[model samples]
Target: MPNTPERPRRISVEDQGPMLVEGPVEVTCADGSVAVSDRFVVAVCTCRRSRMYPWCDTSHRRRVKREENTEAEDGPAS
Candidate 1:
């Protein structure tokens, strides 16, 4: 027999970035290792800028905010 799966608090996709995941989760890798964040819902970093990978440190916001394209081609002019 196996234990019931724990339900996450919330999971959502950012408007322009990685999927936001919260709540307790049992993450696993190809190496057959597993980890549980068990901590209260955390803003997982989908943008991949955190020193702590897979966890949100609000760094993504900064990365995304700096998307000032210097050579953006002219779109339909307003």
Candidate 2:
């Protein structure tokens, strides 16, 4: 059998969300620790708001404006 060069992994960046990367991945943190995921695709947190750290838990979608919440609670201004 002949050996071939491995193809580069694909990564996708989202403007307002986590960066998607082709996985079975290993993530190294600034603290010199590593997180591993065997999923086919992984969502790496970019907003730094994920409770799961290196992995995203959809926390970004829960971000809501304070004003929007207040308006909704106030029954709309006339």
Candidate 3:
């Protein structure tokens, strides 16, 4: 929950991907400028390894791929 924004209107966990953020989003950058908008979804990173900081820059996909590769390498239970 490190990425949980305060007072988010809605947050949804997408199927096998990032959590989609929606509603009135008030973004405050390091420069101190604020932007408030109520609109569509924003993909929030769940992997905690996004270069984009707070956004889902497809880092989770990499994790998923790694997991899949591990599973494949492990093969079936004997």
Candidate 4:
């Protein structure tokens, strides 16, 4: 039998969240470095606030929530 190429990987993107990708994946970063994952699925960071760059550590959730709470307490400036 002839060999066939594997199917393309699916990546889910959101307006304000990490990109969900099927793994294992090899990501080449902007600095010419590579990030690898062996998990079944991975969340690639898009907010650039992750302690683990190229991966999601749920920092977006905590940071955004904290900022929102702060703004609510301070209220709008006149």
TM-scores for all predictions = 0.49, 0.72, 0.45, 0.70
**Most accurate candidate by TM-score:** 2
Task: Assess candidate 3 and give its TM-score to the true structure.
Answer: 0.45
Summarize candidate 4's per-residue lDDT along 8-69 as a digit string, tens digits: 78899976889998888888899999998889889999999899998998767754433356
lDDT of 3: 0.65
Residue-level error in angstroms, candidate 2, position 3? 14
- lDDT for 42 in candidate 3 is 74
Q: Please list the residue runs of candidate 1 whose C-alpha ends up more than 4 Å from where it truly belongs after superposition.
A: 1-9, 29-33, 63-78
The model with the greatest lDDT is 2
Question: How would you encode candidate 2's per-residue C-alpha lDDT over 1-78 as one tens digit per residue?
Answer: 222359777899998899998887889899999998889999999988999999999888865665558677888799
Whichever of 1 and 3 has more lDDT, that candidate is: 3
Number of clashes recorded per candidate: 0, 0, 0, 0
Pairs of colliding residues, candidate 1: none
Is 3 or 4 the stronger prediction by TM-score? 4
Give the higher-lDDT candidate: 1 or 4.
4
Better of 2 and 3 by lDDT: 2
Worst 10 residues of 1 by lDDT: 1-10
lDDT of 1: 0.60
Give lDDT tens digits, candidate 1, residues 29-73: 447776567665555666668776566666666434566655576
